[model samples]
Target: MHQVAPDRSWPLFDVAATRRIEQAAQAALPPFTLMQRAGLATARLALAIAPHARRIWIACGPGNNGGDGLEAATHLAAWGKEAVVTLAGDPAALPADAKRAWERLRQAGLDLAPAPPHDCDLCIDALLGIGAARPLQGGLAAAAQAMAGVGRPVLAIDVPSGLHADTGAGLAVRATHTLALLTLKPGLFTAGGRDAAGQVWFDDLEVPAGPEAPCALLAGPPLAQPRLHASHKGSYGDVAVIGGAPGMAGAALLAASAALHAGAGRVYLAPLDPAAARLAPGLPELMLRDWSSLPLPSLAVACGCGGGTAVADVLPQVLPQAASLVLDADALNAVAAQADLQALLRARSQRSLPTVLTPHPLEAARLLGTSTPAVQADRLAAAQALAARYACVVVLKGSGTVIAAPGQPPAINPTGSARLATGGTGDVLAGWIAALLAHGLPAFEAGQAAVFRHGQLADRWPAGEPLVAGALAARAGG
Candidate 1:
């Protein structure tokens, strides 16, 4: 069994992929080998979590997931812990592996409950797994609700029952900890997975999850390369912030300021309005440049900040030749509306230019021509779709900012807060991403770091103080 953390890279699997791995591992290993390992792991985790508990409630189902629970009950019994089990369906209805486990539990005299285990120390939820076809109902629903009401921790096997293994967006058991057997699921890292499967612990059951198509990913910690003591400003590279149309100059300035603070050697602003030169009083370091005079690919370009409608005109040239690109707000909207621009964005994917798109749900809906509710409902799926369509790294921003690469597993970011809900925050995020790109971080890392840090600032904002966009950007160092 391995551990998963916010700062580490890990594999994420979908239902089909996970099933294939289990099948392949079963075929290669002895019959019941994986089940034994799963049961052992589950038993160990239960004991560790609720060591002094007098009773364990095992909710049995009709599949292999249930068999895993049965096997664990046997272990718990052997260890002298009182085990009570309630069957949702007849034992004869169990699948082959589950049937064997049911027989083992029966032989051990461990199946003792028709009623719920009152005041049990731990509720082992084994009612369903990736194979669940629909929502939990009947005895299963009552049992899940009962488990939740107990106020004790529930340990789920394989997955929280009823959750969509691929999307993590379905009715699920409120498990305090899930011993994900054989493979780590992508759902557990995104959507409702984070809350449904608390503090996920994987066993892998000694099963090898071979190479397959991954639907999403968990990013590892950022690297540990040290900066040279004698490094100069030129070492970090320059960044040019483009997009502040007339009244939205603050957006461009926010991004410029972020890049400057995030270690960019220098920062420039190219505004849609000619008067940006005289407007920014507090920003003495930001040099204003005309769109025509903006530097090319040598500098990372952050486009569409406060762009309003003028972003459409600037994208044609910038798409073909920016050093690196981070598109936000109106720039993303412009690409969504124009087929010509969409083709250019797609071409960037082929060019392998480091491109990132940071779009909240509404902006994402504009890009995909879908409803905002659809995007928000399955954020991981939406982010991955945008990445595949544009062939660029995509940041589907919202409660859980999903970072998806062209052909890599998406990382569901675990940082940020409600404080970032105000305006200008996205602009600050765009700038931070631009700074990372300017400093030569890959498109994937650049987006991940910026989104993570942006939300982190919001999460750690001073309790009594207001957390506006400008102040949020200033806390980038934290």
Candidate 2:
């Protein structure tokens, strides 16, 4: 058994693949061996998590999940712990394994009750596993609700009761700790899974999954690149940020500052409002230029930080001229609102020019012609659709920010926290990605690397100090 963390990459399987693995494991092992292993693992983890607790409530359902709980109850009773079991399903209607487990519990003199025992320190939820598809109802629903409301730590046997293993949808059990059996599901790391399954643990039950392709990947930490002594400033390449129409000049300047701090060789800032501050006084290195003066064909261009309506006028030129482009903020909105711009954006794929689109939920909704809730319902699917529609890498920015590209399995970023929820951080991310693009990384890799670093800044921010956007940009290099 091991704990799940963001330091290493993990293969995420869907419900179908996990079922296949389970079946194969059961066929190879002796009868009830898997359940016994699961039971033992659960008991050990429970004891480890709360060793001093005298009473542990084990909630059992009608399936194999409940069987594991029954087996655990027997072991706990034999070990001198007061294990109280509240069974939600009919004993006669249980599956073969669960029925056998019930017999074992009865033989050990452990009686099953209909309601949870009071004054319990820990609750083990074995009500519903990954097979749950419908709304939680009946006795199982009541038990799950009690467990969630009890305010104590909950140890879920497998995937949370109601969360969809494939899409991370549905009203799921909010477990304090979840033990993923056999394989890790993608839902545990993305969408609503992160909040639902707190402090996730993984125990394969000694069952090795056979050769099956993973459905998604959990993105890990990025490698550090060492600058060579022989390298010059020009070796890093140029990046130009074009946005800041009228009142939103701060947005464009934030991107420029981030690009500079992220190691861009030469950074240029072009504002849609020609009267916008010509120079970023604090950072004298940033060059202020007119949009027409930019050699878009040679530099990596980050557009739409705050382009407003003025960005629409320049998109036609930027779309065709920039060597590599990152369309963000208002630029993404402009593309979503105009079919001509969308056509031009899609045409870049045929020319083999790299492009990345960064959009929050609302911008993504506008682009896809759907509501924000619809886009967030299944973030992976939404991001994948955007990538396919534009034939480019799509970074759907939010919790568990998803990175998707054409013909590639999506990656769920594990870094970042609520500290990034403040304004201007999105602008910082756009500049960070633009810097990586200028460094010549592929669009997908650039998105992942930049996002990883950008979030790492927030994750490692000093506590008690406010995490504003300017400080975040400066710390992108730190």
**How would you encode candidate 2's per-residue C-alpha lDDT over 23-107 as one tens digit per residue?**
9998998999988998888888888888887899999988988998898888888888999998888999999988998999999
Distance from true location, Cα of 14 in model 1, Å = 2.0
Candidate 1 lDDT over residue span 163-251, tens digit each: 87777778799898988887788777666777788878887776666677666666654664366899988888789989888898888
Can you tell me which runs of candidate 2 are displaced by over 4 Å?
A: 279-281
**Candidate 2: minimum summed lDDT over ten consecutive residues — where?**
273-282
Query: lDDT score, residue 317, model 1?
Result: 90
The lDDT values for all models are 0.84, 0.88
Clashing pairs in 1: 7-220, 7-221, 8-219, 8-220, 8-221, 9-220, 217-409, 217-410, 297-323, 416-455
Indicate the worst ten consecutive residues by lDDT in candidate 1.
Answer: 217-226
Once model 1 is optimally superposed onto the true structure by TM-score, how far is the C-alpha of residue 224 displaced, in angstroms? 3.3
